[model samples]
Target: MLFERLRTLPLRLLFSGSVALFPVSTWADTAAKVAPDIDLKEVAPVPRPEAKAPATADQEPSPDADEANPVPGEPEAEPAPEFVKTTRFSLLGSDVLPGTSTRLAWTPGIQIAGLSQPTPVLVVNGLHAGPTLCLTGAVHGDELNGIEIIRRTLYDLDPEKLSGRVVGIPIVNLPGFQEASRYLPDRRDLNRHFPGNPDGSLAERIAYSLFENIIRHCDMLVDIHTGSLKRTNLPQLRADMTNPEVAQFTRGFDRMAVVHSTGSDGMLRVAATRAGITTVTLEAGESHRIQEHQIEAGVNSLTSLMEKQDMISRMFEWGDPEPVYYESSWIRANHGGILFSEVDLGARVNKGEILGYVADPITNAQFPIHASADGRIIGMAVDQVVMAGFAAYHIGTEAEVPGE
Candidate 1:
């Protein structure tokens, strides 16, 4: 039963065991314009340090030091190389420049404004040129896991040793973040407002500004998120494995257990893909709460990614080289009542297993809910009262279909 359950579970891509975000493609294509190449130009490279002269053996041996210290023929310690660093280039029509590992809030150019409020972005620059990695968090606002993860990562990475640039935007939907809600103040899903309109609604303007100023600038991206308030999730990755380049990057996350769907509309990953950007999602913990392990995993995973980018030399030790994959789905409540989940995050469940039970607090009657397919329980609702058609739990397997 356990093995069968594992086979049916949906795969959630865990970013260091953390949760994951965006917009649809058509709109992004129209609104998210990359800064003109004129904004950047080649400059002279910095000179390297001169080599020191070799020491002469006969020059001097102190009678007392000869016995205590090593001979002059012994190799001397090498001098550390002096690295020339470049600053992050300013975005178009704006003079804002991000410091190494610092998060910056932005105000887009008139070309990007549907209205005028600062759009937030985080930037971490590398000492040398390489890929620019942009990570967007909390696009839905309620997905708090990414917000914390991006903040901590930006605060921790040292730019002096970085190989490529890293940009993090912890909360793109400032209004939604402020409300601690999923949708923006406009009551629209910011994720659905992708590649927004500078002349559109409040949400559209914000989305358009981000796409123009931030998303279009990066070569790679990782959007972070979490399960909704009522549910909890196990970590996993979501990527469009159909694209060879994206599949390669997706395989880089040593801990990712699954590769789920990315064909949906108005999703940031889909938009990025259409724009010829490599993007993926990382799912970690529940909404509105901090999970220490999840945070640690996210930071470490990103650092390891930095290492892979040759931005840094340090490596983090995680688990096995490969992870399982699964297709997943949510099980909605058939009846209205309080829920008592029998399975926890990462727990395996079989078809017909009593994964949880719904009870009417007033009537004190219980109704057991079963898994329709074999898989692991990646997410479950914490809220006891569930209305019919309301999602109660999420299940998935790590198995890849023959062609998927």
Candidate 2:
């Protein structure tokens, strides 16, 4: 009985530091017998495989899962929205926001004895996006008609309804305007120096400043002027029609005569055109004093041009279209004396027609000045004086005229 009890003991318990003196079947029987009332099934170890915890319904998937498991035929995610940008218009360090107007005084670096002169600038920025038009007057300071024209034009503009911006410089040559002369204090023609050199002469420096700071901002330009040196021009446009853009600009002035001429070197129009800006010159009455009729005509023409460009919503009424003359000549005086003109501007004359005559008060002699071609009188000399070879009349010939 003692040997049977010893053999019935568990071999695992005996091997875990206690010596086993029984077989395997005997050890199983002994373990069953030892734990009979202690429940032997509870003491046995359980076997299981490794697994992850189940996710709750409210939990989100990992980033790797989102990238790996894309929905079928679904587009990629969109980027975040960006901030909106607004348009701002500025000139000569002065900002003119949309639907607003401002005046800027531009002073170039060129000075006389430590004194700088400011050129008057008027800017009107529109509420909508569109082209920029630049209007310049009094390039020759003595040309007062353009100054008045610009003033009247600016006075009538409403920035709130305008489609684009308009920049007006009523007086470009301040020194000449103050002195009532057509040139600067140094006697240089300011209009002749354009796209000027920064390190060049005084006139050139001024031109550079104006061109770089003011004109370079324009997509289109209109340079207003009047006849120079005691001469009067009928309302007309002078432009180089070789450029289609310039030709279109000339057409904007409905009833004004257009004279085709490539402007001289260093001229503002020429320089601006070379830099890809479409430009035209509007010539009106004579210089030194303002002519009411010329000023009125200039104002109307500019208004009509703005209308054509869609800068303004108002529709301007224009008269019958004028002729476009490709060729014109000046009728010069043959005798030196006091002069009188029998014909007025815009008068049509036949070949050899007597438009004016020169009278010599000393010798009581008179000479008739006749038109050499059948054309309209576009420009004439002032009635004050006459000299041999003086340009007395300008005839706008129909020869070589281009089709409208």
List the candidates' TM-scores in order: 0.72, 0.77
10-41 in candidate 2: lDDT tens per residue?
Answer: 53232221243433352233221110011111
Question: CA lDDT of each candidate?
Answer: 0.63, 0.75
RMSD of each: 20.6, 33.1
